[model samples]
Target: MQIVNKAVVFESGHEEYAVPIQSVISIEKVNFINPIPHMPLYMRGVTKAREDLIPVIDFESVLYNRSLAGEEARLLVVQTESLQIGLLVKDAKEIIDIPQEALKQMGIAAYEKTKYFIGVAAFSDRLITIIDPDILVSSLEGIKDIQEYMKQNKLFPA
Candidate 1:
């Protein structure tokens, strides 16, 4: 018997990326994102979802070094062990089952930022870069600063 992992595929720029479906809480359309001061450039701001305020990050900027243009961007609400944050993506494509065998370990040294990627998998006719949400959330610049802001603003419990 083999284990099959499910992933939510989304588009960012010209490439496709996947995150384990188990980590995803919901997919949401872009709504009003209130900008916060003194946060990282990639940190778009905060938004209310399901009666809770969540910080949203511009994943395109974090991954591609540029913010996404236009109004078609969507939010991928991901929940980790400690935190739940919104990741801005171009679009949410579909949920697909990827075999464990199909995932290939990527050489961390070869990539400029190795922490952002977990592995690669073949889906359809393209190779999708699998994103590690934990790393992505933890590695963001000014995360602590944002957390402090949230706490000060009573957005997060101290």
Candidate 2:
């Protein structure tokens, strides 16, 4: 018997990406995002989800260098070790179980360049890039600086 991993597939622009379903908390439609000053372009803003102010990132901008231009965008709330953030995706697809053998690990050089991507999974006719939530959350440019700012401003608990 082969072990299988489930992933929450999503579309960002024209590309498809997947994150381990275990890391995802919930999926919500794009709502009002209160912009934060001096943050990177990828950091869309923060949105109120329940009692928490979850920081949202424009996944398309981060991955493709393109802004997400549509009202149909959705947010995939993911949790890492130290933080919970929302990743903006153009669309949220279905959850699929992928065989462990389907994931092809990228080379170290490629991994270093694209820290957010763990590997690529070939499914049917499409290729889905597997995203590491931890890496994606931590690798954002100016993320630490902005997180410190958020902490200082009392936006997030220090």
Say which candidate scores most in lDDT.
1
Error of 1 at 94 (Å): 0.4
Q: Write one digit per residue (lDDT tens) for candidate 1, span 74-115.
A: 889998655788888988889988888788877772575657
Question: What would the TM-scores of all predictions be?
Answer: 0.90, 0.90
- Angstrom error at residue 116, model 1: 2.5
True-structure RMSD, every candidate: 2.6, 2.6
Expressed as tens digits, the lDDT of each residue in 1-158 for candidate 2 is: 21229999999877888889999999888878898887899988899776688888998888778878587788899998768888889888789888877887756425554777777788678888888888777777788977787788787787
lDDT computed for candidate 1: 0.82
lDDT of 2 at 90: 81
The per-model lDDT (C-alpha) reads 0.82, 0.81
lDDT score of residue 75 within candidate 1: 88
Best TM-score among the predictions, by candidate number: 1
In model 2, the Cα lDDT at residue 128 comes to 85
